[model samples]
Target: MNARLPERQASRALLIGSSRFSHEGLHDLPATVNNVQALADALTDPAMGGLDPSGCRVLTDPATPKQVGDAIDAVVNEALDTLVLYYAGHGVLSRHGELFLAVEITDPDPYRVHYSGVPMTWLRSALAESPADNRILILDCCFSGHAVEAMSGTASAVGGKLDIRGTYTLASAPAHETAVAPVGARFTAFTGELVKTLREGIPGCGPLLTLGDIYPALTRALVASALPRPQRLNTDLGDHVAMTRNPAYRPPSRSASKPRVVSQPHRSPTGPHRRASDEQDPKVAAEFHSAMLDVYRKAKKEAGYNAAYFLQMVQEVGGLEAARRLIRAGSVSSGFTALWEKGRLDLSVEAVVLQDRFAGLFTDEELDIARDRLAEYGYSSAQTS
Candidate 1:
């Protein structure tokens, strides 16, 4: 059976990576930081996972179990279609042979782990309780394979015997083996391959990538690199859920023998004006332009400007009307802050509406209002211009 990508708005992902450790026995994994960031980028890429940036959350160096649990619970509550929980850090075994995910203050003592670490059983229970149709748990730490055992009802860990349905658990290594994190590497061994697969994609896979398609490729790559083989446990076709669009997929070309027909340009009317390529509604044009700007900024690794919500105001009212609303609102919007954070001062509303291509979209008074808004935020028109 064919599988498709999850509904972007209905799916949520929480990525947790503990990169530092205060314990003497546990070594710090600096690569885990890069692992979370790179994975977040891959998942939020429109050409790949197509998830909204707001839907994916990254937590680094969590201080306690409650912090991680709270974040997971939030995502579980928000996600209706798919929930992805990813963790990268140290995995230590307790006295009862149970797995415990190491946090910033985690100690090596088995008895102390109850207070310092997050038990694998906690994750299992969370997944079992989640209302999402598909639950994906990715663990990149030593003894992570124990999670598979716990979910399968074979592990003797406390609270590990829960029946988790519609879940897929992917572990970096065997229950006894240590996951690799080569020194000076950008990402952990297992996650590096995962990110590569999400970015470059499998050559022959169809248009969408599923867990079933990714597992064998991961196995082959890890074996070639002489790394510990990954393990997985899937229940109720969970493996068939599509994770992302295949980057390497190419649609078949049209037949060369088909005859070509040329047609006159179609003109759309806007009030008393008619244009061949312009949108009939100025508000719609503004929204489209704003969304396209976000796509461009994202490709360049800049922070998103929250174009969807911001542009909705323009779509509901015309550009000039939206400008009046913004002036009356008397506060800078999040989109402007996002632009400021990315050092994209040039994309501000004052600069955008002032561009030659958008000259007539807003009146001089509206342009002055935009400039005044920027000035209120301590930016000059000359700087934005």
Candidate 2:
């Protein structure tokens, strides 16, 4: 039998959904409860996140201010290594720009929000104070973007802003936009698409699904539904930090007996001589890089904004055989670059940190060329240093 890989860090989730409100003007949302249950189920699926059912809490109809605070404290005080907080309901914004998660008895009155709603600041404080190594916040409600604005930038204590370290925040809409819950649907637009992405999993993204892989798909799904576009605030973790395992991972077939080898025809003496080193021809590498840029531009324009689907689109743009040739030739920089742009930044300072990894896959000449091109986009050695 093959040895299994060790499990990921222990993680817990708290899902809250509010449907009813004290004010009659705010109609109850039928999809909110469904969102909580579906997400909870996915979190507990062995083929998915594999979280313990007892560690995942689902609070429907939204708990009061005190209950929400207590719940956060209890979860964060545990010995878990990671904590995820998800809220699906009506997100309210005060005149001064503070955000709140509306509870079952929350009053719609703009002036009385303090008395009825749970302030996002409270949750932020809890997360900032938590001992967990990683924290994730997913908000699927109107004006969820305010949460991102509330938590942006490096760790600091002033203004009650949460320390941005070790945290990833996914907001369903812009600060002023309304996150829609389609009537009769099983989940909210933001979460319904999220669930689908989680189930299908992303190709070329390995056995685990990180928030980095999920963001592009979720944004495209919401945009296609004509719902508010999702926003994300991410921290630079050196490598991909996974939130869950792909539901579709399967072990490779094993063989007990010795494997057989097949022999190929020997090259004729007159045939072209092949180099022993893995380094690729400079001209061929340059051509491959140029072709990749063209394909990336076309893919960006025609493949829509969903990066998850672009993997197949890329295969279609360049035939499978050509891709295989590039890989065999050790010209993997092009493909690595294409994959990185699928979800990560195009030309931000963050790209500088990833330059070494992407360039390492290239030959010396190709690496020089890549550095030159990246420098044109402000990714310079000085910046990274």
Candidate 3:
């Protein structure tokens, strides 16, 4: 075992979320993709007290395991202490009791396997190669047991013991159960609810927000949202599930400079924004915003993504009334929960304008989703807030 560990817990994270990938309808539902992305963002967030935000890397399938492995490779080599891995999407188990990632691959032979998912065993080995003191893994897929069972059951990554102290693992649901999520509302589904817990509701839970407290809260939320009742279970692979070993985590001192923390992401020019202010030109920012926009626009058609964007952008250009005509035009799309409260769920010219206004002044936290909505409307993500 590679017993030598980091002086403190420096971490590197890898996030993977598979979507409507398998031909056999693996990611057949919208929630499947949305949940994966949400979970990825949650896990990679440095604010979660998991890792250095800058060190997180995300990989998607169709993208090879080699490519995925390669990204994690860089972080591991950097000597980060904790390695946090999160996966969201579909998983498949074979009669032979093997677990696979079930990418956008299909088995043409029906009776014979044509494509094989990424084996979790392969991933555990990769983590073993890292010099980090601990590893925290989270998987949000169906049939996730064998892979984790394989990783945790085998001894020898942390210290001399295979089941090392301080190594933590959390799985969305237990093995063999078909986890359920909304057919299309991925973002607000079970996974989304969990993020909400961490983001908006944790403090409300009172006192210390331990993983023991947090994990089950999220699990209960997930099972509660399951339609027609879901087959669900949460697992604690090893004994040491140290909720979060936050090096700098502490209650803010009641001092003159102590600022009340708000749940919103918009907290002014904090990290990246401030950093970008120094070197990035407007054009570079535009490019970054635009690229992500394209992907969002493509997806907006199904959700109310585009309408909101169109309304907002129109206000940014012409005026509020001009945006209304578009909302009143024709048949509305589905999926998104009606969020605005301009009297009705329908995007009134006024709410559209307000939406646009909010987008203009979006808190950094709200910015990404706002950008995605803009993308639905074919707007650039880099629109200066």
Q: Write the per-residue lDDT of candidate 2 for residues 6-91, one digit (tens) a residue.
A: 13346677898888776785778889999999888877787665567777888888547777777777777762477788999999
Could you tell me every candidate's TM-score relative to the true structure?
Answer: 0.65, 0.66, 0.50
Model 3, span 1-385: residue lDDT tens: 1112122236677777666454654545445455555655654555554444466666655444555556667766664566666677666665555556655563323233324466666566666666766666666666665454656564222123243334555565556665555544536244566567655534322232344434545644565656222121122222223333322234433551232344555644443221113123555334434433432354355333444443344435433223323232211111111222111222322222223323332233333333344344334434333
Model 1, 104-152: lDDT tens digits are 8888687778888998888888888888899999999998899889888
Residue pairs with backbone overlap in model 2 = none
Q: After superposition, how far is residue 350 of candidate 1 from its true place, in Å?
A: 62
Q: List ranges where model 3 is wrong by over 4 Å.
A: 1-9, 25-33, 40-50, 106-115, 154-165, 188-190, 201-209, 225-385
Specify the highest-lDDT model's number: 1
Error of 3 at 25 (Å): 4.9
Q: Candidates' lDDT values, in order?
A: 0.75, 0.62, 0.45
Indicate which candidate wins on TM-score. Answer: 2
lDDT of 1: 0.75
Identify the superior model by TM-score, candidate 1 or candidate 3. Answer: 1
